[model samples]
Target: MIALSDTVSASSDLLSTEIDGEVVMMDMEAGRYLYLDRIGSVIWSELKRPQTVADLCQSLADRYAAPIEQIECDVLDLLQQMRRNDLIRLHD
Candidate 1:
């Protein structure tokens, strides 16, 4: 599972984000478009790195100076929302 801590962008993919921080996804394979929000932005930014759940929790905790437990909860909750929207893929 990807954690919500680091940020990443690949050299290959092509998708343009809008002025209001809303994401517009362009599917290279299917040739389509999509949209995302500010909350999505936060989660998407974190997915830039191939980090584990623990690593992401640590990063969020450090960024907000919150407890690891609380950050872990936030990470899990945020990832859950992202997953529901098909914003990100979760790996084993």
Candidate 2:
């Protein structure tokens, strides 16, 4: 699934996330939370859009001037890691 999780509602626990920014955790499970860089932040925003992977990759490629194939690979790897870390959830 290219999309992060359109049906998986965003948790309020994650204060906010932005490109070139970070994800704040008010009630963090573990203190000193994980941080994301500019590229990760961009992917987070695209996922926030509730867009499918296809759309997200296309958008990322366009925004960053990268090849779609490369972006797709990045997205898959990052998303899998995020999912494993419970940083994100898939719709199903």
Candidate 3:
């Protein structure tokens, strides 16, 4: 499970490209490709370096005028999905 303090980073074997504001990622190890929309693209960009879930929430909250609770929920959901897909790594 992803905690607020847990730091997340992109998997080393993944390569990403942005096309018209969206992101396309290739996982070399998994031999799969994934796509992200505008918001997911932002999340992908942030994960280039290790960052805590709290930092991600705050950064997203700053960009969008949404409630922190909602942003937190959405971010957590996305992170969990990414984790399942082996697109990101979580640090304890």
Candidate 4:
């Protein structure tokens, strides 16, 4: 499992675009495309640079009405899913 302190960022070779508050990502290596909703898009934008899971949760908490714990849980789950799909990568 990814720890809260682990930093993560988008893969360098992937292509991404934002449309109507959503994000569309294409993995050049895997030849797969993933669509992200508004919340996912926000997370995707933040992943432009490596960031800690805590930072991501707090950022979303400030912008969204959800609880911090819920945000953290959701963010962690999403990150793990993205990792499995080779969309985002863990950084040092």
Q: How well is each residue in 1-92 modelled by candidate 1, as lDDT tens digits?
A: 44444332222354656557766777576587666577556556666655666776676667676788877787777676655545555554
Cα shift from native, residue 59, model 2 (Å): 0.5
Cα RMSDs, all models: 4.8, 3.6, 1.0, 1.0
Cα lDDT tens digits for candidate 3, 1-92 = 88889999988778889999999988887788999999999999999999999999999999999999999999999999999999899886
lDDT of 3 at 84: 95
Reference-based lDDT, each prediction: 0.60, 0.62, 0.92, 0.89
> How big is the positional error of residue 81 in model 1, measured in Å on the Cα after superposition?
0.9
Candidates, ranked, TM-score: 3, 4, 2, 1
Between prediction 1 and prediction 4, the one with superior lDDT is 4
44-89 per-residue lDDT for model 4 (tens digits): 9999988898998898999999999999999999999988888888
* lDDT accuracy of residue 31 in candidate 2: 50
Of the candidates shown, which would achieve the greatest lDDT relative to the real structure?
Answer: 3
How close is every model to the real structure, measured as TM-score?
0.57, 0.71, 0.94, 0.93
Candidate 2, residue 36: lDDT: 70
Q: How high a TM-score does candidate 2 get?
A: 0.71
Order of models, best lDDT first: 3, 4, 2, 1
Clash counts for the predictions, in order: 2, 2, 0, 0
